[model samples]
Target chain A: MPWRRPRKKVERPIEVTRSIEESLEDAAAGEEEEDSVDLAGLDDATVVEAATGEPEPERGASDLALKLRETLAREPAPARARPRATTYPESGVDLAVDAARGLRLRNPVLTASGTFGQGIEYAELIDVARLGAIVNKGTTPNMRPGNPQYRIAETPSGILNSIGLENPGAVEVARRYGVQWAALGVPVIVNVAGYSVEDYVYVVSEMAGTPGVVAYELNVSCPNVKDGMIFGSDPSLAAELTRAVKAETDLPVIVKLTPNAPDVVAVARACEEAGADGVTAINTVLGMRIDTRRRRPILGTGSGGLSGPAIRPIAVHITYQVAQAVGIPIMGAGGVTSAEDALEFLMAGASAVQVGTATFADPLVPLKVIEGLAAYVREHGLRSIREIVGTALPRMVE
Target chain B: MIIQQGAVTASARIGDLGTVLGVSAPGIAAQARAGQFVHVRPGTSFEPLLRRPYSFNRIRRQEGEIELIVRPLGPGGEWIASRRPGDLLDLLGPLGTAFVIHRSARNLLLVAGGTGIAPMRVLAEQEASRRNVTLLMGGRSVAYLWPSDRLPPSVEYVTTTEDGSFGIGGRVTEALPELLRWADQLCACGPWPMLAAIGRMREEAERAPAAPGRAALLEAQIAVEQHMGCAMGVCRACVVVTSQGNARVCREGPVFPLGDVAFAEGEPATVGLVS
Candidate 1:
């Protein structure tokens, strides 16, 4: 049986480009009296035409346009002078933001904890330098062999995992990956998880001076282990754990919130009150799946953390609510697979976005998100990505 | 490992086994080994989200082609199985560790079940010229057996079906003891139950007196399978308990020493190994 479909070659409509050019010309004529043509809203093709006095290349045209626009946007010219520059920006678009107190990243795209695996695994597939930061897997005071077989199961537009905070303990993680992390170029954020406050403190202390580690993301929201969600679900316990980690090290402490918590916003506030430098709004939601054939749960742990595009909307809602309640910068995470998904968090008041389950589907997703964000910034004429943060929030009347 | 958009050169169904897809991916084919696999995307979008892992069924470097045996078990599998010539496939491969055949071993035995014949076929083609090779395959029916004509002529092909419609009846395990005495090494790939059966046999051989084939079974290396994500070794989703603790099937294996793997209750032993 031959199961082949005839290959369909997509033909780009040439009229689309002509029509865009016509509209750009009209906009340019109308703006001539304003002393400067706002080419910001123009499509990349028209931007390339206006900048280089030539048509865009069939391939890599958008990338070239972004690079050119970034360069022009950086170097300021006299009020009415024509913008001309062939150089690429030394530092690309201002995608940088204060991820945590004293923890500033070069960009706002970070690889989420657990999914990044100490940053070594994906380095073979993508350039680690392109990411804002890499959050290593959750580390505990003792080595964890993790959960049993059937650790993963696919759900609609998502996956459920019961990894159970598997790691080689804090000391071993620092010893095994410290030197490598130092040379990886990307900043490292250690995700600390444990059954007790001492476990969290011990892990923090052990990883304190490890090279390349810029901060700590307290993983109190891991739902796969016993007592893992206790701190995350309670305000006092969350504050106590945050305070313990803060006392153990001077590194910025960011608490990852659990959506299963009774009041996620209250927990965020509690962490902030306990001196947390930042907050990551929303970890995976608690979920389960049953194998119909076997008439039992699919995961070995009975239930697992649900993540992917299916949870993106829930994550955004939590981020929106938490952003309104807290002053600390929020690191939004859920099922962010695209730049548009990341943009939703940013507009809802998140300073950066962590890509988790999406990486399992496409390792290049985080890099693609970075590029897409740059395109969005250029298209909107935004001076800095920080300007877009909290834009969706209700404003107070004067 | 490189990620490439491979073009499907051919896709066809073979009896009751499933669809076989030939992909023109030079990079993957050039580096692919017997036991390693490729993670293939089902569609352009994330609806059927995760990529399915398939071992290399055939690798032709000169033609820059690699073939995969796709069993249409789910929506993702069905989509991949139905792909036609000239279709672009997103592939990340030549991943996981390959089977290691000892240089001194002159007689090699390979066991396969159902679609697990993929990696075994590669071993037969690769090691036939270097050593005396025999392959034992088992299926529920004759329709599920791999075609004997497709294999290298030098390979000794043995088959068993549950319904006795093919070669020997029952299972590969029934034919394994006799062949164990003649072989110097054993390697297998199949469902967990089959591997568990082999695991049990290995345990019995260890407890008994030293025999010609018992050493080979004890030293056997088998490629294992599990529900996987990210195949890049980051997700920690495909881990199985081993003598060395939890090991990711996508990285540390797909291939592992039979003795090192801990199987319990007909599935991978998941409890009590660690606290």
Candidate 2:
């Protein structure tokens, strides 16, 4: 007789169907357990079972199949449940923060001074009411025509601007944008830039009763104009200017610090001592770009203030240092493009953040940052975003 | 003005002139007028940040397509120019003010220089069928000249090259006086020097006695270019001194009446008095 294999035993279709049903039931039960039960307490085999949703081995199964099933069942569940730990909160996390002592806002994101022109310009493109507040273009006691041609130039990841604080006089700005600002439903932080303490007082006095004016952002560091940075760079001048403005208006006074200052922290401290409610750490760093082809500087002024991601690290360091040194709130500015960047400032002790040149790249950046912060808050299961503020600071030994 | 992602359908180098890109942006094309421009994002990242503003080189509303003439100069411009078909572009437009064409005017003169031909080309095509339109374009040389075939057949095209390699030998100013007399209205877009030349001519006409087309020169509208930021009115980076005050190029203009723009030494006049 020819060599013949032993007669193979074939299982009935009904039997096969029953086995499959048993296997599926086991898998379903494993998946249910994985969904409802905490996997952290489970053993390695149970975790593998939960992960793979594989059924237990059947009787008469091949050795190979048994071994594979055993290996899968023994494998540990993936390190963590998932990257996102918690669902978005029903009420959502609060993004509100204070720009100054009494200048509380619904969000921590505000438009930087000068970058946002009186809230009316960007109001057409975005919902202005969503912003923490808007710091209007630098306004003076008198109308300014601003810098010459080529007032702006693009640097690596930032913008260099020498706009020379161009604005209609305080009267005109108040007259032109008062109703518009009120209508926009966004608080206005008047950016006051002046040649002297008297000029600052004049501007504050001019804007005293303007509707929607919530506070004042003293732009003492406008590097584009002559003598504009004097008050910002000198502690005494800054203190005097802050005191004069404080005397003029009951509005919260925020001194915008200039990085070009020989000692920025001293100026901040002086302003705070002079009754400033808050300080915006670090204005644009002075920078220059030359057009090799033209054989000359690109800006009308040889130097312009650089603002963007290029200055973000420097801004954060300053905010961190100032936050430790000052008692008043710190409004962090300079290259705050995302919620993470804002969070960096917040954790470093900033009470709020201002978005500047990044707005040039994307008008919706501030809004996006707000959304991102909310997402972060929910994911980390933080009760409130403010809980993260100053978390990165060194603790006191006392 | 809306921001939309437009897809490039075609891109090609137009000799030594610039790269021409056709983007399918229905919203921008539908609302676009002659002098309005689109701020195009260079890349997905913010490395070479800041959108590049380009006046629409060609707009086809029915087809929902817009064209841009991009000179690959900076990294941003190079990135925009190198875009191929199917690439997406972020566009914010049709922004800024548009060139205003008076309906009653029978004769319309459009002047352009170098890349400024973008808006002028649009004016030529749009006004060709409605009025007696003449487009006077000047470039540094033959390399910078806009292709004649791209213009509408109805438009009367005149060109000047500084090198005498094309049309009239010299600047558009050389060919402008005779045409200014023939035209009832004038619109121009060009470099600061070229626009300043026209502004000087307008000033001269205003000082002298009334003559044919003198009024047109006085009322001429020109689209200007500057080192722009935000393209939105917010940045205040593109302000040029105007008769009224400092006017934002992105809002008050890219288009302004020639008489309103202030020029000093062939550039936008600087505001000398800060106070």
Q: Which regions of candidate 1 are displaced past 4 Å?
A: A1-91, A222-229, B272-275
Q: Model 2: per-residue lDDT, tens digit, A1-398?
A: 01111222222222112222332233344333543465556554444333333323343336434543443332212112322212212123556566798776656788999888887766555655556688999899998777766788888888898888887799999899887665555578988988777888899999988877888989887432445457788898889888888988877899999888999999999999999999998799999999898998988778899999999999999999888889899999999889999999999999889998888777778877877887887899886677888889889688
What TM-score number comes out for model 2? Answer: 0.84
Per-residue alpha-carbon lDDT of candidate 1 for residues A1-398, written as tens digits (9 for 90 to 100): 01112212222122212122332233233234322354555666755544333355674866885765543432111111232211212133556677777666657889999899999777666666557788899899899878876788999999999888888999999999987775565678999998788889989988878877888999887432445457899998899889989998977899999999999999999999999999997788989999999998888888899999999999999999999889999999999999999999999999999999888888778978987887888888876688899899878578
Error of 2 at B24 (Å): 1.3
Candidate 2, residue A219: CA error in Å?
A: 1.6
lDDT against true structure, model 1? 0.82
User: CA shift at A345, candidate 2, in angstroms?
Assistant: 0.7
Put down candidate 2 lDDT per residue, B120-142, tens digits, no spaces: 99888888999999999999898
**Highest-TM-score candidate:** 1
Model 1 per-residue lDDT tens digits across residues B218-239? 9998998989998998888898
